[model samples]
Target: MSMTEAQTTTRKQALGSPLDRADGRLKIQGLATYAIEKSLENMAYAVVVQSTIPHGRIRSMNIERARQSPGILAVYNHHSGLIIHPAKTFGQGGAAAQAFLPLQDDKVLWNGQHIALVVAETLEQATEAAALIETEYEQQAAIVHPDNPDARPETVDALTIEWGDAVPALAQAEVQIGGVYTTPREYNSPIEPHGCIAHWQDGSLTLWEPSQWVGGARQVVSEWMAIDREKVRVISPYVGGGFGCKGGIQPHSALACVAARELKRPVKLALTRPQTFTAFGGRPRTHQQLALGASRDGTLQSIVHDSWNETALNDVHKEPCNAVTPLMYASPNFLSHHKLIHLNTVNPSWMRAPGENPSAFALEVAMDELAWALKMDPLALRLKNYAEQDPQAKIPWSSRQLREAYQQGADAFGWSKRPLEPRSLREGRQLIGWGMASGTYPVRRTPGEAQIVLYADGRLEVQSSGVDIGTGTYTILAQTAADVLLVAPESITVLLGDTLLPRAPVAGGSQLANLLTGAVHKTALALRDMLITLAVSTEKSPLWQQSPAALALADGFLWLSDKPNLRVSFSELLRLSGNDKLIAHQDTFATTASEDDRNKADSTSSMMVPPTEGGVSAHSWSAIFVEVAVDEDFGTVRVKRMVGAFDSGRIYNPKLTESQWIGGMVMGIGQALLEEGAIDDRDGRITNANLADYLVAVNADIPELTTIDVGKPDYLATVLGGKAVGELGIVGVAAAISNAVWHATGKRIRDLPITQDKLL
Candidate 1:
């Protein structure tokens, strides 16, 4: 059932209205439970010792000295008790990013690999013991950088897309522009570091961890321990933050479980800030050579994006650098290539907006260069080449308002008052400029389940294994149930982050609000059906002779569809039917991308039921405008203002979605002016891992941030007419900021974190 068609009562607000988060009070009052905060009897703490050498084999390790230290319980190196079988979660949509299991062998793939696990009576003792343990390695000459002499190109097939020939077409075009754009490695670095608590009870292993994929962890852990799937339980009731670091299982989680079982006590482990940068994984640095050939009129003719990213020797994960390259603009000929260069670096994992983030950084800035070459306004150039449909997929959009976003965002940003020449706008020793960029992200909807129960006391309960990751999942799910059952949002209780609840998809990809809410919708439909059947069979129910099809439920009451006054409370209906409550469960599974065209049910565009719409590509679009003030003397760039407009199908909560976009835009400012993960070239160690050295945009750094929502609903995308919204806002943000810097200084720096040194 579409939320657009949902029946409501006096509290009719839902789906689009702003509702306070249901868990807000619990969090503020410190009553909310986190994995690391959980207490159990005889609990121990563990700290991991990381490998210092980039590439080498452990000659030997001596843990005796550390084991005899104060409060020390046990210490395990490759030579000790830490033993486990290899994991099996691989292939399509697997959970594990780094295949090198912790403490499985003496081989060191990179610096910061887990070399040992030290357990003690307390966290302080464990930390001290971990530092005291001795390790020696037979270090080998290693290639630490992807551009090293020994680096070899490994083609990634999934990222390579071919259409018409791009090289020759570029040679014949009227206006051509291209350059090599580089972005440095960056960390996820959530406010609360990744941690987990593992325990074993009656042969069943349970884990309380901050993980996005609870089900995936259970599946992987079960295989690693050779235990039955039902014997492994992963619960994560609350997570502080998860950009992409928490999307999959980390090596520490597995190690914690192994140590807990061997010691027969609960073990807790948490990564330090520095450990998170190295052991947990970060965004890989990328270099792309791009070329854009356009007509004198600024119509794109040929486009090419060829790129390489840093990958480790043992693990192979591609960034899909060309994910946003092929279809954004109306290019007739385009070529996209992704190549991997193996280095002695730790395996990199997904950060937020993994593929599209870096892709848009290069693509959008290159578009600005092409516009300059054609002597055209940047926004005008983009308007001249707006794609009416998917250039590569040849499919119409499910719902798109990108044009409105561009126009509205431009109007709000005062694009009409801007001058084309660089260094033209000046204010008291500060040079000012304005720029814009377009953004896009595929709407990725995964399958999930929800369990709903209607009580005899006229209250409702909903349960799921889904996590929030600070995106307000608890609030939206409550609103969905309230709308479906026509009950006050406060009267419904929502339970999540427990494996015991109905299984749900990971909270990444910004799909939780769509998929989990759909699960709740489906469960509600089943429950309504059961209640209607019971009401008709009760004989004393209002209009007992009425058809089930003609009976409509509203505001916790049953009545004939046409007779608003003829009604019986749900509690009364339950009493007559001799049941205390009603329970319903549903699992939502998405069909193939093309399945929507063959059968409408294949769209499954919602969380509750099969889709009734068909034949379109579902995507969210965004546009951003940035104004920067660059100090002429010091070359310091400060963003003065920003305006963004988004078309993400339907708005679930305006305040939440607006905050999401603004947060992304702020991160974009950091990407353009302040953030980079610097790796030391001498020994392949990560430098500046601490927050003091790494710069993120603070509240003082931002001025005016305006947002506009294109509120048109999309029935074809989902029942709520909503597409994925979380990652869309950051897609083209860095590019827009950098473009503004170019307009201010007439100096275009293709590399990221456009620093003072580059600006001067």
Candidate 2:
């Protein structure tokens, strides 16, 4: 529990400098252990048996062949020894992507539903035994698509928004545009497909899973298993990637524990790449209809966004497709409807930038169409509709710099030199065009706890169960601690990815950094205050004569505020006090601003109001500019380059922030040019489940990327002045690329994956 005395330093890392990950050496040396790579004394492997039929009852069960297979210990069906509890939503503070439990009955709700599990001594045996299991089903007609005559889609009241009538206002506008845009279902496609290792002993269960929220996982796994919360332990030390797919505990995670407990052995379940498509979750396919009405001067008069998304047979999770419509633009009369259509498909769930990614393709393209009707520049149209305050929240914005982002982006991308008409600009044997779109994702914050310990030797340790899904959690926290403690990065050690550590919010929704920093900020300040108190508490020390109120911390010393040279180092003071280490723990609640800042400055968004009035709306904004080249004869579109100017509150580490932006652009390129999850209507199976059949972008597809930040810190979002950049770069990327393709070829493809056929 104590660091060595030789392991401390008093130098600090530069705030804007990039820091390499602390685990880089461990990973490169093959010493890092993933969930599937952990070895135990005796471990069993499990493979799930999926339902062949979309909807119906299992008429006859046939598990004799699988039960008799070599090394097969058990083949469990609904009537087997396995007992499971139905899914329940965690509380507001708890993290869960969805609440649909599996394997509770013999009725098949959808194809690829996990109906049975085969546990064996080896992975080969488990896989072979799973393939041998077969069942007879009473086939029933399935609802494959929402367009079916009998299909009924229900509008979600909570998701739908209405204000002044949008119907009449649309009819009265001088310029109007109506169009339908469709985005295909997509997979999470993290390199590390979901894998779990479950062990149970003495009525307690332990799971090593790559979950985004270990605390939430413990809560759910405990509840579903009828056990105490403390009895369940979850560990996710280093996640390969989440992208919202592994944000919570999936049903397979529980199944592994169930099988492990039943067989009295550790169970390991690893999903194959094919199973990754339908085993857990994927982004729902969307059909978005937009009607944009604008004045002759290109100001929005009205806007309505109607969406119908695919859902599973009984799953009621709603994709917030209309979420962006309420916050993005200025429209007096707005109507947004989100309807869920029942389909015989796997349960659809969140992907990166879930609603905003696909929704932007529809709304931004409609805005472009309105711009053409009004004969206005696209960027000019966006500036005309800039919202000073949140449209739906009706609250003052904490911080907004979208206008500056647009101006900076346009200047960098050479917007003034581009031809206004599509197909008017050309290169040798190719047509060149430029286009742009605005992007935004809300700045979300959550409550968290951090534990800090400062030793007599001057070393520090910070602990939290924060999962690092390759978003630089380790490096950023080290930088934060170094900056706060006035110590070198080597002196600060961050311990996370364990359930026993302090609980942290899930690492999705772009919230972890903002929320984690708040906790760290509060905890470090508490440690500093405690040190000041300890240094002046008694008359035995030099600082005992000085008041604690007049002390300032610099280089691990508490000195008089007015006299820089009069100081006593913490090490010497602690040595004299006969204490080895100082400990402090703090839980922070996210507020609009720091107490000092709130008490001092007046808050303003659209109107000036008292700073402490209420919480504020926070959003990270970007203006994406893209250039594309279309082969005139072949009808192929290629992105030549991309430039994005973002106005996220503060840049914690500019290098990591730029890396995240480039990765998001690559993901957007995949969405615009290639990436689609195909389904077979005949049997409801995911077609092209494997990578060989389903394509993603490779190194050859990546284009030159340029990411620049406005570089202004806004304290309103958080006292640290940092906004989330995780999902900010992913939104609006597809729309920007698609808009550029239209500008190059003079053909607008509303459907996603603007493929070669769509180009022609």
Candidate 3:
């Protein structure tokens, strides 16, 4: 049925008590077995030997002395196994990984490259032995910045969206603004580090990993080992958090698998917190030039964004740093181009809103500048240029509430009280300012599969391979199933984090709920149909030959449309069916893309769910207003208060949804004023590799925050009618904070983290 038809169906009041997450008790009690907590018989510990020099060649490896050290079982390097092959160079763009295969080759292209791995009986012994191994290397000069004259240009990935002659339009425009904005490198520092436990049993490998994408990890592991994909089983029942860092398979997993095979025992490898900076992955630094031309009345005439980013020597990674600029406003002429420059740094990977986050920083900041130049209100200017249709794709949005978001956010934030001039408001040596930004993330959905089982004991079980990653997936899935099955959530068991289960999509792109929940709802509907068919076919049943469509399942009982009193309990029906359990599976595929769509040609946009109100094609929208107090003397910016309004579709649980927003705001605050990855240009080493030196948003840095969920039901997206809200909460936050900083200090800080040094 079309989404409109689905919406026409009366909204049913949620049945049963508010559904509690089935795994909440286990998680709170620390009974949940995360990858690092798993224990196997005869498990050994492995420690990685990493490269100290950022750019160099390993002349010789002297491991004899360390091999003979106490508690060392085996030391493996590139030449250990004939079957171990180096990682193949994949086609460029964003598909590249950060740290390439360990022990794959001898040359160290980037600092912290894994050169050797030591396996020992104890974690301490393995670590101590790893430190003992020595190596000699020939250092090479490296280029870590795009502005460097010696930097070589490479084509990592390129995306071109052209509409009109931007150069000529800019030449004819009445006003123009040009500036370069740079975003520093940063790491996604989840509470739990990337880790895994691998065991090789008769050539098949089993691994317990903390990952967001289980199937992706399985694919990478299989490819790394040259083993059949089915031979690799990856399980991640509970991940502390990934934040896009744990989406792909890293070197440590492969290292553990190889170590286990050589030692004939389960091997566990967890990167030290400092090691994670290099061992895992980080967001690449972006250098971009924005040229915008507009009319005297603030109408966009032309916009051209050219960006260059760095990738590793072995792989190419590109961030569409200008992705949001073209579509963010109504512009007649626009061009966005990206180039990759090879650096002696680890390959960068996706972080939250990898492309748009940095892009928004530049675009929104530039918009603020343009507003100031035009002596116009930033919100007014944005409203004037807002696109009713997506200018990039030339399609109407499934549903866009951006104008409503701005109006509500401004009303709630008391925007009328703010002074127009920057640095005009101050109290007690502090400059106070308020800033806001519009946030948008494209709706994304993909094919997903789920299985549901109904037991005779009045319990339901939902199975999918989707990992939760701490976003309340378990609770939402259970709630969706319970709402449909008319069963209590506590009585329903949700099973996930196994590849052998029904094929589910990866838990990235904020699309998990839109993708997987539809399959769950569809499966529940099918299960209800089966139960009705069974009751109707039974000779002893109340409505022996009733049509299935004339009956409805509610309150754990089946009743005819005309006779509510005549009903049979689900448990009773199950007993009559003479079966202990009944199972059904569902797979929901994406709608075919039209031939005229250019996004279809690109892999990133191929699987994107088309614009729909509810059937797995919903987008979440939010507006973040930030209040900043800047100390002009010390160049310190403190977030005093934050208020956000989100249209996340229907919130499954108000408490969890609110918490997600708060968490996202906290993370956004970090991205705005604290998080940065420091690199030593002399040797291309990550100087502040540990958490102590690399700053994050601490409790003291956080301020009073309020999250308001405008729980508008999206009728076009999914069975639940909820859009992907996880990433939207963070998408435009940095810009809001940065804009606030600009308002407070009267200084346009183009760089990220708005550091004190930059302010000074």
TM-score of each: 0.94, 0.93, 0.92
Assess candidate 1 and give its TM-score to the true structure.
0.94
Winner on lDDT (2 vs 3) = 2
Q: Cα miss at 365, model 2 (Å)?
A: 0.8
What TM-score, to 2 decimals, does candidate 2 have?
0.93
Model 2, span 1-760: residue lDDT tens: 1121212333325345677767777788988687778788799999988887778888878999999999999888887857767545432223444455666677887778888899999999999989887899998888877777767988888788988889899999888899999988888798888989999999999999987778778777876788987798888888888788887678888789899989889999998888888786688889989999988888888988899888877765567778677778999999989998988777787788877777777888888777777878899899899999988878888888898889888898898887878888899989997889888887766556788888888778888887788888777777776666665665678888888888676787787787677778678888888888888884566778688888877566767777756767888878877889888887664355464332111110111122223567878888899999999888888889999989888888788888888888888899888899887878788889988878888898888899989847868876688886988888888888888888888898899888988877
Ranking by lDDT: 1, 2, 3
The parts of candidate 3 lying over 4 Å away from their true place are: 1-22, 86-99, 155-157, 540-543, 546-550, 559-566, 590-619, 715-720
lDDT of 2 at 414: 91
Candidate 3 lDDT over residue span 440-478, tens digit each: 666667666799988888678899888899887887777
Per-residue lDDT tens digits of candidate 1, residues 1-760? 3222446342456556788777889999999998899999999999989998888899989888898999998998887756676664233335665677888889998888888999999999999988887888999888888768888989888778878888888889999999999989878778889889999888899999987768767866776777886898898888888888888788888889899898899999988888887786678888999999988888898998899888778787677789788767888898988999888887888888888888998999999998888779999998898988877777787877999999999999989998988889999899998889999877776666788888787778888888888888888887887767766677778888877888776677677788877788788778888888888888877757678898877667788877767878888887777789888987665544343321111112223221212567777899999999999999999999999999987888788888788878878888888889888776788888789887888889888999899847777777667887888888898999999999999999899999999988
Q: Which regions in candidate 2 have their CA more than 4 angstroms from the true location? A: 1-14, 90-98, 538-544, 549-575, 590-615
User: RMSD of candidate 2 to the true fold?
Assistant: 5.3
Per-residue error at 54 for model 3, in Å?
Answer: 1.4
